[model samples]
Target chain A: MKIVIVEYGMGNIRSIVSTLQYLGVQDVVLSSDFEILNSADKIILPGVGSFGKAITQIRHRNIDNYLNEIVLENKKPILGICLGMQLLGNSSTEDGNNKGLGYINGYVVKFDNSLVKVPHVGFNQVKVNNKLKLYNGFNDIPTDFYFTHSFRMKSDVEINQCYCNYQEDFVASFERDNIAGVQFHPELSQTNGLKLLKNFIDKF
Target chain B: MLRKRIIFSLIYSDGYFMQSRNFRLQKVGNLNWLEKNYRFQSIAFALDELIVLNASKTEKNITEFAKTVSDLVNDVFIPIAAGGGIRTLEDAELLFNSGADKIVLNSLLFQDPNMVMKIIENYGSQSVVASVDCKLNLGSYEIFINNGTKKLDYDIQKYLIYLEELGVGEIYLNSIDRDGTGFGYDFDLIKIVEDITKLPLIIAGGAGNENHLAKGLQINKVSAVATANLFNFIGNSIPNARDYLLDNGLNLSNRVFDTLDLI
Candidate 1:
């Protein structure tokens, strides 16, 4: 299968590509070209850095157009990791109010620094919704995944959401049919992450 | 619940990985030898994070070290923090582009606070890890920088507060006295500074075995435990240690997926 990882001068594209290759995926391409994304069997919207800057870069490359066509119109399965996941939400309050792809029904906000440490780093337990294809093998258990971000997403709608609690529970991952997003780096989460990525490839 | 982490650190000097003992470098082997012996691709399963530091006492080359980091991280799925001689923003950018999820800073935090702030501004606070080397002297912890060679005028408590003010995400506090001794972590040093800052603390320097790792993790304030003693925990030692920690009901991530199933 041809897996295209959207690259816009942000995120850990190298780690995602290397992880995909390790999972025996051969035709992995890191490009923001419309044709490359459109031709992909699956699309991974990997991202890091600020939300405002990320949105600007995505628009500059016209990746928002590519994603809309390939993922929304053509119905290709897509997985967004970390900040990539946040970009799939309705909007984020980071770096001024910035709009997202609105692929999922969620809003991103900064973690209450008064309540806990900002930029919650390291491995944290995520309560998985195994009913979703994104968390197939987890068996509805709490699993650890690497998280390093200040802003988190929350949704009122039931989009098959998984929750992780730092001080308060927030959306850890969600899957609405073919579209999926995880607020952790599956590429950097060891076997469990690899398993999740494999599910994204096969089950989705 | 946020789980504690078990991290493995690899000290690189020149072209070889060194066995560091009390801040002294002893060349062990090259990257090929490391892969042949440790097989980090597989060993990574046992670790929560991996830190590769360029401790080259001579002139440090960011490009060459970054290349080694890139090579070492292939197929190893975990957060890799690489840094040693990051003097410029481009130097920090090179390592991050190479595959580093976070950049470790030591001397830069002191020598160039403005440069450190610039890096944090560029990469966000979460992307920077401030590594502080400390040695106990006259009933107080003394701060050391530049690969533990130079001493700083700042006290340990004030230095930690300074790091927090610098907006680093985590603190990698390494004890120079117990560096590679394999005895255990310096609880005396850890106790004094664990609650000083709200940032996650990763205690390093003197972990010999699984017991040492467990002891370090038992501390409620410590977020992670790191050991660079290559000779002590070789082969399947790390994997066994993880299992041991899990079996003993430690609050570590118990999720295990067989990646071999993918192949």
Candidate 2:
């Protein structure tokens, strides 16, 4: 399958590409070109920085416009990881109030450092809603995934969601039609992560 | 629940990966030797995270070290944090672009606090790990930087507080005296400063076996246990240690998936 990782100069694109290649994807492309992005069988949005800065880069590079056409209108499958997943939400409080793609009805807020540590680094168990296409073959269990972020997403829409408790339970992964996102780094989470990525490639 | 981590750190100096003891380097093998013996594709399953540090001494070449990092991370499917001689933003960019999920900073924490702040500002705090090398001196933990050669004026506890103020995501506290000794982690040093900061602590230096790792993880403040003892954990040692940790309930990632089945 032709996989395109949308790159706007903000995240760990190399590891994402390496993971894709390891998964036997022969035609994985890291490009934000209008035609290339629209024509891909699957698209991954990987990121690892400030959400405000990332959205600015995306808008400046006109990627926000391209994603609207390809992801919103055309209905192509797109999986957003970490900051990429945060960008698919309505808004985020990272750095300052900034707009997201608004594909999912959610908003991002920082974890209370008083309750739990900031950045929330290391491996954490994700309570998987197995009914979602992203967790297709996985059993109904809270599997582990790597998470390292300060801000988290919450939505009242009740989409197929996965939850992880750090300071308290927060959004881990969510799916809405063609749009899916994980607050964890599937590329770095080892086996469980690789399995989740495989499910994205096969089921989503 | 947020689980503890088992981090396997690789020390690369010049052209070969080195065996580090008391901050002294000894050439062990090259990338080929590592691939043949460790086989990251297989052994990677045994680690929660991998830290690759560029410990070159004579006029460090950042580009060559980053190339090694990229090549090393190809088959390794875990969070890789690479550093050592990360002086500027360009150097960090090269490492991150070459497949490093986080940048480990040592000397910069002392010499260039601004640089650390800049990296955290640009990449966010989650992408920066502050590596503080400490040595026990007369019942006091003295902090050392610049590849563990130069001793800093700041005390280890005070330096940790400074690092926390800089907004680093985690602290990789390595004991220089216990390094490569295979005795165990400096429990006294860790006990003194373990509660100084709230950031996730990764205890490194003298983990010789699974029991040593378990002892490090048993400390509630220590978020992970890191080891670079090549002599101890080379072949089946990693998988074996992982089994020991699991059987004893170390809170490591217990999820099992066929490495080949992902494809």
Candidate 3:
């Protein structure tokens, strides 16, 4: 199966490609080409950086339209990581109020500086919800995944969501059928991350 | 339950990994020698993060170091932070493109605050890590930059508060006095600086064994502890240290889902 990592001039695309290949999925491409993105079996939206700037870059390449046509309309499986996951929501307050792709029913807000650390770096425990395809083959409820972000998402909508606590509980991973998003870098989460990538490929 | 991290830092200088002690550099080996000796790919699974710093004192070339960073992280499945002399946005971008999950900046925090702000504006503050090389002089804590060659005339605690306001994601506080000494970390300095910043603190430089790491983690303020002494942390030593930490009931990740489990 081919996995195309949507590369619209963002962070850690090379690492994502390398990690996919390490999982024995060699036919991976990093590009914004519509044909290549649409033709793939699975697509990954991986990013690290400011939300406003990332949307600006995505819009510059018209990737927003492509993702709409391909992921929203076509029902192709997509996984958004970190900032990419935040971008899948409605909007983010980081770098000022900016709109996201609106694929998921959520919005990003910065962590309360008075409560916990701003950028909650390092490994944190994630409580998986209902054995979704993104976390299949795992029975453990709360597992460690590497998280690095200042802004976070909170939603009251019902969905397959994984919860993690820092200063307070926040969404770790949310699955809406073929579309899923995780606020942690599964690529950097060691075996737990690799297992997660494999589940997305083989099960999702 | 957020887990504390054990990070291994590899010091690089001119295409070679160096063993540093008190800011003194000694070339230990090239990439092949590192692979043959430490088996870093297998070793990477045992730790939470890997940090590769290009401590090149002579004519620092970021492009070359980024390529090395890419090479080292190809199949190594962990969060890798690469930096040393990142002075520009392009330099930070190059390292990120080369597989660095985060960029480490030392001198840039003191030299060009505008450039640092620009990076934070473009890449988000979480992508940039402020690395502080600190030392104790005349019973006062001082911050050093430019690979420990130049000392900034500011208190270490105050510098961290400044860094926090700049919106850096994490603070990599390395004690120059304890680096590679196998003695231990400067817990006193850590106590003073830890109270100042709300960002995640990664304490480095001077961990001789698992006991030192445990002691560092036992503190309520420290988020992670790191070691750069190659002799003390190469090969199975990392995995052993991790197992020891886990066996002792310290809060580290369990490797039940590791790649080896797939094999």
Candidate 4:
């Protein structure tokens, strides 16, 4: 059960390693090596360009203090998608105010063009906030995936599990326990985004 | 509560799949016949992001056919809107990390109207969608760009009131002389952008039948209505247009077109 995605150079890493080898997930590892992303068990990261060049390439490969000491002082299980879920929050206004990976509290704003339309891309519908397990077997409230961002996560955080509405209501999936975040693109989401990447690889 | 939205548009060229109203050109299969039959029957679907416009290929084969249709519709559950030739903000962040949930921007909003406030400051104006390929000219209905080829003197109701002060959640007004010519929509230019913007408007080209999507949903200020040759050359689908809009009584949005059989 070794996962480790976090490539750095900024997104589309061979389509998230061909969507984790089309969900068969043969011990996936793209690595930017922070000791193999702190000896992985499961830590996916997947980002896609600018947010100050992916937080200056994760503080120029200090790997953001070994991903805040393996997902906030050794909790383990991590998954961040879409600019790696806006760099796991706590700071980001986009081109000016930086600092994120605060491990999830909230701070990424920039897509409220008054009502909607700004990198919100396509295929959206998600509501699930019922105590997440990476939406185990999906569907609790809205559940239609695949999203492109422009900065979200505001709705007064607190690990928002899911919430999507285009011109307003933001945060579309966020967890704190083992650190999870999904603004959408569960490896380009297809069969419930490959059953949410095989339920984050059957929770490792 | 208001959630019913279905759209299915796949008109690519050169790299394949382009047969909407006899343009003829099909190849790219395994669309899994749209997920083994319209993936829970369309509440929202679209991929007509215009095959990299004016095609002829190469931007590395249109980013390898947009990453093979974003990895074959990344487990499609519903809502999918990808629009043609998106301009920048890194081509909408590589089609939102290649799985797109919504990104329809037309000719880069008339070639950079501040790239729609820089894609609502990087993906937020409801994931940015503002496509207007209108026509009418003299009597006043302008806003055309690229695909409809040039024309913009502005005033398509003052550029949808400047795309409703640049926060545009959704507006896909299309109608280029009744696109593909089925001749239905343009309900007076969708009642002039639904009498000046409330937002959520998706009226593409001329619809054809189903009473022109039941007169654009009996003008309750159209929230969604799209037709590419009335469901790809009159096959109809989306449960036959939601059973002809609930047998003409109207009032849709019952999530995913409300469990269909329509026969």
Candidate 5:
């Protein structure tokens, strides 16, 4: 199966490709082109950096439109990682009230600096949503995944959401049918991350 | 629960990984030798993060260093922070493109605050890690830049406050005195600097054994503990250290992935 990592000039695309290759994935392409995205068996929207800048770049490349066609219209499975996951939400408070892609029913907000340290870095325990295809192997146990971000997504909707706690519980990952998003970097989360990616590839 | 991290740092000079002692570097081995001796890929599973610093004192060529970074992080599924000679935005971008999840800055944080700001602006503060090398001289901590060669006038407290104000995601505090000594981390220094900033603090240098690591982690303020001493923790040493940490009931990740054949 061919998997395309949607690259709109953001994130560590090399690691994603290398991890997929390590998992014995034959065809893993990193491209933002519409045709390339459309031709994939699965698509990964990997992102890092600011939400405002990412949204601006996505709009500039008409990637939002392309994703609307490829993912929304075609019902193709898509997994968004870190900032990529936040962009799938409705809006964000980061960089002065930025709007997201509006795919998932959630909004992003920065962690209260008064409470916990900002930019929650390092490995954190994620309560895996075992009901979904994103986490297929583990039996409802909290797994460790690498997370690095200031802003986090919070949703009131039932999206098969998995929660992780820094100070309070927040969305770690969510899976709804073919659409999935994780606040952590599966590509960077060691063996646990590799397992999650494999689940996305094989099950989704 | 957010677990404390066990980070393994690789000190690279020219094309070889070095064993550093009190800011002086001794050439240990090249990439092949590292893989053959340590088998870093397998050992990386026990690590939360990997930091590769290019300490090429002669000429810090970012392109060549980035290639080495790329080679090291091929299948290692952990957050890799690479730096040393990242002067411009293009240099930071090159390292990120080469598979660095985060970029470490040392001299640039002091030399050019504007360049540091630019990198922070583009990649966000979380993508940038401020590495401060400190040495306790005459009972006062002095900060160092330029690969620990030049000492700054301001003390570590002032420098740390400055870094926090500058909006860096994390602080990699390496004690030059304890570096590669196999003695232990400077807990007194950590006590002084722990309350200065709200950013995640990664304490580096020293740490010869699992007990040292455990002691470092026992301190509530430390976010991560790093050890760069190659000889101390070689072969199955890291994996063994991790198991020891876990068995001792330390708050580290213990998720077993025996289903590698699931895919």
Candidate 6:
């Protein structure tokens, strides 16, 4: 399937492109153009920065409403990673108050320090919701995955697929029909990460 | 279902694998080797802290390097803690924006105590990590900076108190003399730092095997053990560390490797 990765000048773009290429996905394009983004068969929004910076870029581009309409109305499969996943939420309190794509019903907040270290750096385990099709070929439940973020999604939304505990329970992966988002970077997740991308290419 | 914590060491300097006592910088394995073979269940890694040496030399370039490192790290799923040349609030911002989950600062904390306050003001205390490279000088331990090339006269215990007062999220204590020796960790030094601070402590330097990791974890004051040569040379992976820790009865988080099936 032809995939389009949203480029908004925040963080790593080449790595995601390389990952897609590694998964045998030849039809991948990184574009900031609205028409190109809206016309893609599959959309992947990958981010490595803060929630506020991402929301700001999306808003400045004036693609917030368009993204919401495309995902919620058209049902095109879109995957959001790291800050991209946080952007799928309603709002975030990173540097300041910022509004997200509002595709999911929740807000992003800084991690509570009482439970785990902030940024929740390094590798941690993830438990899948089992009902989602994105995790098709993995057998080791609670597998280790790389993570690097302070703000996480706190949603009362309909697409909560997986949750991980850092300080407290937070959304790790979520899916609402064709719209799926993972808080972790599937591209950075080594063999398991590649497996995830392969599943996305195969199933979606 | 025990969760594992992984440790990583970032070799900032240009160097190569050594045999016996001779050390030289040679082109070694590809980065893919780290991606493919060196598997740890959960790992903690390091950042090149080169701020105190000659700030003017690496100051402007390190921020961009952080971005490059972030992109490189995105291909691997293990947890990485980036240190080196972190000085101001802007440096921390650039690092985090570049995809660093944790920032390890040593020179900045000693040079200007307010730097921590500024970080806490912006990113909260939990995101700021105080990295202490300590060495025994005479009868007391002193803090060393600039990649363990310079020694500070300040007492390690006093600095630990000051770090606690500054409200840092975590502390990474590395023994400079023991680093890369593969002999084992300096448990006494770790005990001293742990006795002074309640924050989560990550111990680095001189981890040779699973037994060293198990011994380090037994300290109770240490939250995690970090190694560079051990995982690189000793052939121990993160999964092996986790299995050892789990078999020992430590309650770690549950990892689900089968989630790939959902795709």
List, for all models, the DockQ compared with the true complex. Answer: 0.79, 0.85, 0.74, 0.03, 0.76, 0.18
Please list the C-alpha lDDT of all candidates, in the order they appear: 0.91, 0.90, 0.88, 0.64, 0.90, 0.65
Off by over 4 Å in 1: none
Q: Candidate 5 local accuracy as lDDT?
A: 0.90
Model 2 chain A: worst 10 consecutive residues (lDDT sum): A159-168
lDDT of 4: 0.64
Residue-pair clashes per prediction, in order, are 0, 0, 0, 42, 0, 53
lDDT of 1 by residue, B110-174 (tens): 99999999999889999999999999999988999888889999988899999999999999999
User: What docking grade does candidate 3 earn?
Assistant: medium
State the lDDT of candidate 3 residue by residue for B1-263, as single tens digits: 78899999999999999999999999899999999998888888898998999999998999999999999788587889999989899999899888888889999998898999898887887788899998899998888998898989887767888888787888899999999998999998889878887778899989999899999999887989999989988779889999999999998877657565653
Task: Name the better of 3 and 4 by DockQ.
Answer: 3
lDDT of 1: 0.91
The candidate maximizing lDDT is 1
DockQ result, candidate 5? 0.76
TM-score of 2: 0.99
Quote model 1's TM-score.
0.98
Name every residue pair that clashes in candidate 5.
none
Give the poorly placed runs of model 4, Cα more than 4 Å off: A1-76, A81-84, A87-91, A95-98, A103-147, A151-184, A199-203, B1-76, B80-123, B126-128, B131-154, B157-161, B169-171, B176-203, B207-263
Angstrom error at residue A133, model 6: 1.9
Q: What is the lDDT of residue A78 in candidate 5?
A: 97
Q: Can you give the lDDT of residue B258 in candidate 5?
A: 53
DockQ sort, best first = 2, 1, 5, 3, 6, 4
Report the lDDT tens digits of candidate 4 across residue range A16-37: 6655665566777878777887
Q: In model 2, what are the clashing residue pairs, if there are any?
A: none
Question: Model 1 over residues A1-204: C-alpha lDDT tens digits?
Answer: 889999899887889999999888889998988888888999999988899999999999989988888888899999999999999999999899999999999999999998988888877888887877987867677888988899999999998899999999999999988899999999888888889999999898
True contacts kept of each: 0.75, 0.87, 0.78, 0.05, 0.82, 0.19
Write candidate 6's Cα lDDT for A1-204 as tens digits: 679988787655555766676566778897878788788888988876567767778778776766777777877788888888888878899878987787777788987766555556545677864457777756637765566677788777567568777756788888777877888777656566667777777776
- Candidate 3 chain A has its poorest 10 consecutive residues by lDDT at A128-137
